[model samples]
Target chain A: MEAIIPVIITSVCVYGLFRRINIFDSFVEGVKEGFGTVRFVAPTMIALLVAVGTLRASGFLDFIAELISPLAESVGFPAELVPMGLLRPVSGSGATALLTGIYRDCGPDSFAGRCASVVAGSTETTFYAVTMYYGAAGIKKIRHTLFSALLADLTAIIVSVITVGLLMS
Target chain B: MSYIFGVMIALGFIYALVSGNMAALSAGIPEAAASAVELLISISGMLCMWSGFMRIAKDCGLTEKLARLLAPLLRRLYPDIDPDSKAFGYISVNISANLLGLGNAATPPGLNAMRELRKRSGTEIASDSMITFVVMNTASIQLVPATVAALRKSYGSTQPFDIIICVWITSAVALAVGLMSSRLISALTRRGRIWKR
Candidate 1:
């Protein structure tokens, strides 16, 4: 299944040549456009990247993590995982680090670690995708992208909680 | 986002001063920028490769085939987009690749699809289709969270895909709800209804 993308690309190339399309020319055209887009979005991406890094490093994420465990302490999830759920959408690497850290600290079979695993898998970097796509697409008015993405992330979090409750218990 | 960046930096600075991790905070700024650059460099390759394939696919009417397949669902979602446009092809690729948990490959096609949607939009403001496309891409319901599978494997899980049902259900719910919210908001906010042809 992982090979599907490569297979798709190769077949497209072969099909392009079979159709007598200048595959090289079209490839170059696409590359040029991609380069232009990268240049255009670099600043916005940088802004997001830097913000994500600082948000993680500044202990703010830790603070949020601390705040979450008490709210639902009855379920008995570890406080260590709250950061993983919150940060997954803001930053992937941060969440991965958090996931591994939680696994190491709490043991992968622990309820907290299981919750982290499910939560991490269930969500995407909603804001990051939103930022990159909007920047690349050059749509100034972002409209409901952020709201919708966050709502999805929230849903992912809620569903993760439920899944863990069902499977881990 | 700029405001968020500023706030983050300011918070970082204040936290560093209060916590005496100023050196670490200062050091992390440049490192973050560098990593962001590295990310773009790698993503640029993915973007170029998939965009080129999309071009090839478009030339061969493969996208039209995809469009035909997804039209019933997407047509109502993207009323502004022409039925025959190549955007549908890329959109289909984006949707499928994401569902299969091909995150990296899903992106270039996603970017391609968004670019096409943006072209159709033609205004600074996002159109309904563009907004919906972004929402779908953002919450591209994966059947398998491949990254999570790898993580589970490394942690010595007997079965890595145990989370598959969970991810599938969660993402499906997220996608459905997100698209509706985005569409509803877009409609509510549509005052001028400008589509530059």
Candidate 2:
């Protein structure tokens, strides 16, 4: 992976230069654009982060975990996979943070961490990504995009979690 | 906005406490934060690649080449829009980006594409081209699942490639459904026009 990083960077630089684009300038421009995106997405993302934080602090997530635990168990989802299901939709980073904690608590090779890993690998950031991108673009007619993407996200989570859980168990 | 999220999160946390799972609540904080950082990094890398690739593609006349290559399909899918129109180009790029599983990367292009489409249509309501584009963009075929792969790597997975089948299946189904729905709606509207006359 480390080896791949330099190769990617070099390829991008070559691609940029080949187009008569100054690599430094393009890098600077890209970074600037990235920061702009951060600012543009800040209000939404910060709100999402805070909501996630408060949920954690208030223990709503655990209640969800507990409530969903039985159904999850029936479907072969481990108990630890609960937080992951909730986190998967809202924020990818949030989900990863949960996965890390599971890794720490259950150890890396444990069934719980593996389930979390599979869930993490299976799902995409559904609502947040769609909202941010569409909102930024000033697209009012998001139409059926949201519903469709969410469906995909749900499918990924269910299939990935169940398959991994069954295999591991 | 943050306040609303804060309230919601807090409410969730309170609910968890009431449910008697302090540990799960405790673990959620860092999870959210780390996940946020990881998402940002992934988005940055993807956007950078897209920005650079788009620039190169445009410079090399690849956009035109792609447009020509996709013109027949676009004509069939978006008969309402002129094949030679700028919106056609933007739509192609947006679709291409989505096909690569770079949906976030597709946003800028999608925005540009929509802007172009709107300019061509000159209407407030969705035009046929715009609707078709939306369907295609929404149903985008994802060849790679970058974010998922990254998360898998972070979680210490040895076989992160395991998700390739799932991605292929889900995205393929989504694309098919989206295309069918858009085509069905368009056909119905065309019939409605004849009925009204």
Best by lDDT: 1
lDDT of 1 by residue, A1-100 (tens): 3454457678878988888888888878766765776687677666666765675566655566668768767665567766667767876665665675
Over A74-134, each residue of candidate 2 has an lDDT whose tens digit, in order, gives: 8576777766676677665456556655654575456666556555544556665555545
TM-score of 2: 0.62
Error of 1 at B192 (Å): 11
What tens digits encode model 1's per-residue C-alpha lDDT throughout B1-197? Answer: 45645876788778767777777767777877786776556556655655565655655656456546766787777777776778876877777656544455578988898888877767888777777888887774665454555555566666655666666677777778888888777666564365431
DockQ of each: 0.38, 0.25
By summed lDDT, which 10 consecutive residues of candidate 1 chain A come out lowest? A1-10
The value of fnat for model 2 is: 0.24
Task: Give the runs in model 1 whose Cα sits over 4 Å from its true position.
Answer: A1-67, A74-78, B1-71, B191-197
Off by over 4 Å in 2: A1-59, A72-169, B1-4, B16-69, B100-105, B139-142, B159-162, B186-197
Docking class of 1: acceptable
Q: Candidate 2: how close is chain B to the reference, as a TM-score?
A: 0.71
